[model samples]
Target: MDYSPHPTTAPSPPPATGSVSGKAVRPGDRIFLGLSRGSGIALLVIMAAIAAFLTYRSVLAISGDKSNFFTTLDWNAVGTEPKFGIAVLAFGTLVSSVVAMLIAVPVAVGIALFISHYAPRRLASPLGYVIDLLAAVPSIVYGLWGALFLVPHLSGLYGWLNDFLGWTGIFSYSNGAARSLFTVGILLAIMILPIVTSVSREVFLQVPRMHEEAALALGATRWEVIRMSVLPFGRSGVISASMLGLGRALGETMAVATVLSPSFLINASLLDPGGGTFAQNIASKFSEADTFGQDALIASGLVLFVITLLVNGAARLIIARRKEYSGASA
Candidate 1:
């Protein structure tokens, strides 16, 4: 569908009328407007192309599959009977991301508020810079750190969780190396923290100073001021920041591959060395996979891509819903 906005025909300014507007079509204006409209059209074309490619490859791979594409537990789409599913991969991806959100969002919000509102004026800038620097560190470095240093140090804590929360089954650790969903979530949390904090900090910082002053004049305590004046204003910003972090967590590949032990089964034990995310699975399997296997991987990538699109769409709706009231940008 050609939904890109078309350039509207606007009458020339009254002072410039009676010229048939031919002479009024300034070359500079024509070039600029044409370029802008063309860019929009180009973007639409690119998006369409990507969707078409994913759909083609995914259909080719799944056409011969015998198993329920959504329910099957294993990925074996390259065999004579070609059976595969994204259930396990999707589950792990969501679980790890959920864990990351659970751990990261609160901490990120707190740090953001601290940097924007609580930190000394002189220290705030430097602290924020440090956080931004953390975000700049390449994902592979995080992967290496997670594998080489974090894995060994996590076994004891995993054992403790198993001992104390084993009855719940969810936290039950299998005494395996700490390459599990929880560990992956922790690494993801660290990796995403800087970005989330940076976004939230900017949002909170943009809250109208008058609002804060009004709250103070009304004798609101610091905590109460934030609760009543700051938080309400930045709620959308915080949501946006969290969504960005979730996006990063979802697409993270190298870090996840390095920190997780891949498997096809889904289990309740979050501290065990098993389960696989979409990105992790694709990266780990693609090079060694046959042609059909590659197609199957592309199918999984399509799913991830769709998931990302849905997440972003939802975030946009959420932000739009609250735009009228959020004073974070005021």
Candidate 2:
């Protein structure tokens, strides 16, 4: 053997045949890339088309509207002057969604934590399955249940709220039928709880094992480990889940229509039986509306669409900012 290596040399790498990371692109990968790109482009085209249609129809409706489209609470789209506005719809939609979020987020987070960290494996599996089943329950079924069962049973609770919190005005009740925005909010909270809980549970489960182990090694309690490690890692996910639930609550139609006594007037109290949401109004009026009325409803729908997009966009921004904190970047 020679004392020195006999002219050591590295083997040449394969040449790039197509657009790839210094390697030949496979047929399967190329096909998948094309399919994914096509799907993304198609989705953008569809969304743009919908926006264009809604804008056109909304203009047709707004051009003839006599009332201020943002201020007036009246919704007489088929009348001679055809005055309509989204003030009350906006108020009801915002208030009910707020109420639903306030009720659902904490409960969902607690349930999620219990299933992910506190519950035994034997108990968690069945509970998670039940939550999945609840999510699959149809909106129409929820609507019927809310209308028939929830509305009737909530009167006593409403009375208690009125007695205890009536001075706040928002919780004040006037002995009306329990078909109010507050009732709608409660129903929506129940409807969305399963979704939020499922998402949060999955997020919490994704916390790095080493982080939890390290916390325990440092003599941290289980609750402290969760507070210091699990919560920070899952904050973004919880926000995303809450936004998803809020979107559902904002656009819920049949359930809200069934539970709420629709009116054009904005009520001072959520417990009062008089308010309307965009989805409920659209579903109730679309079938009976004339062409102009349909256009007006479409205008209101456009507003709702814009609102939902804004909410989701804001959630995305928040998640993006906190992605590194959540260890997603890592």
Candidate 3:
């Protein structure tokens, strides 16, 4: 009985609670969170600063007493009046970009498909590396190549197009040389091709292996399996890649400027040697431009910025929609 009474021991204390939900974060975690927030804020501030600067410069051009700021096709920034408008610039930009996309998209997708689905593993990696290298090459180099080499060789192609498609008007070429919108487009396509192909190939490779295997097990042909499993999954990615290429095509300055001879007129012919783009005009005239002329160029740049933003935004929306549809189907 004495032993039993001595056996009674003290009970253990209850566990300490830091918060109501019983969750505790260390000092390191809090510091990391603060750093992340700071980084985000800094990015936003930088973006805002850039936007403000561009807006300030552009307003000077837009609000100046220049005649026909939006309609005139002239780009004589050094002239006394310094009259100019985005009409020709916009046309050239759109024409070159559209042509580039037309040439690049198909080739890019095909190359991507071949690399992801058809090429041997060793060959695919090397080829992909080469494409990436192409993407990394400087724009100025492309410009020089276009100016010195590509333009000379394109005369034959231009002649063929003019001869066969002259009645269509779009391919009509009055100039004997190949330095035209079409040639610029072709050069742009070559420059942007690597980018589009690399993006597309990466996307296609992300397709689920199980889905591809399932299609194969169901006795589908290789092409059929790809059509069902790969292309569908990568459709959004392909669009995104194409849009990236389009952005590059649209904003390219040195290449277009070096290759294109700008005349202030909007023509329907893709073969026309006369047209300009905002970037090209800026690059061509910015150095010799006066204060007001610089402002005008900045204004054109502002317009280009807006256009690029709109295009990228539209592309994001399309990709988002495609993702939603894919999720629904799954």
Candidate 4:
């Protein structure tokens, strides 16, 4: 008689994964997936198309240059032996952007911190609203105001800087009108301030209540709590905000054109009036330039495009490096 216990059969293999079993996706999910993928592909295609166009135009312009396209300081793009270069443009753009960042970032952080952590709710809400409103103000308005009101009023401050810091060469001035790269930087800083402050304030407001409470429980002071918990969590966000502000300062055309007294010559001192930015140059010259001259401007535009990409790339790297401490990772 077969009385022995039947040999235990091995457990059935686990049900096939979603892929093997062809688990059905919801219609809504499938639609969303397709849309998102299509959007991403479209963005890449558009970017590639723009890059190709810029490259082709730039090659034609550079091929026609009579001098070193990157090093020459002349910008006579008219006659048969035409010459122009971006050396001064590059210098002015970088210097002005750097100065704007230096002036705007710390002030923006302070304003954000005050709004987020220190101000009474009554004051904070209205103040934040005002800052947001400032952001909505047009860049051209800022440019006009800068050129008319701000520049005239800045002479005294420029003189003060020259008196105290002229030996540094950067602050040295020719005692002329205050239409200089430094002034352009100041205008850019003002234009970008609302953006940085708004973004930073939002980030600071998003700090975990529990983390702040824990710091309080440990008898930490307000500043100490912020330094340890809030700042760490919001560092990446602040960086992103700064990068956004920088991008605005970089590609600003109307504002720069309206404010800057553009020239092809590079001045050693930011307080000097002789310098130009790519955006400023393009905006100021594009209308008057001939076909080949317009192509030259496009070449400069290509350089500006490359610069903006590099700035964004660097900002991404910075955010990624600090992701561990940022709430983004959490």
Task: Please provide TM-scores, in order, for all candidate models, with all chains considered together.
Answer: 0.89, 0.87, 0.85, 0.85
lDDT of 1: 0.89
RMSD in Å for all candidates: 5.7, 7.8, 10.9, 10.1
Q: Give the per-residue lDDT digits (tens) of candidate 4, residues 1-330.
A: 112245344344666454664678667877987999999999999999999998999999999999999999989889899899999999999999999999999999999999999999889999999999999999999999998998889889889999999999989977777889999999999999999999899889878799999999999999999999999888888998899899889999878888788788878889878798999999999889999999999999999999899888887787667654542444
Local distance difference test values of all predictions, in order: 0.89, 0.90, 0.86, 0.89
* Residues 1-330, model 3: lDDT tens digits: 011224344244455543543557677867987999999999999989878999998887777736677788777666656677888888889988999999989999999999988999889999999999999999899989998999888877878888999899998877566778888999999999999999899889878789999999999999999899999899888998899889889899999999998788888887868798889999988888889889889988989998998888888887778767655765
In model 3, the clashing pairs are: none
TM-score of 3: 0.85
Tens digit of lDDT per residue, candidate 1, span 97-208? 9999999999999999999989999999999999999999999999999999999999999888888889999998877789999899999999999999998998788777
Q: What residue pairs are clashing in model 1? A: none
lDDT of 2 by residue, 1-330 (tens): 112234353344555556555576677988997999999999999999999999999999999999899999889988688888999999999999999999999999999999999999899989999999999999989999999999989888989999999999988988868999989999999999999999899889888799999999999999999999999889888999999899889989999988999888888988889889999999999888999999999999999999999888887787667665654455
Error of 4 at 137 (Å): 1.4
Query: Where in model 2 is the C-alpha error above 4 Å?
Result: 1-40, 320-329
Candidate 1 Cα misplacement greater than 4 A, ranges = 1-21, 24-36, 326-330
Poorest stretch of ten by lDDT in candidate 1: 1-10
Which candidate ranks first by lDDT, i.e. highest? 2
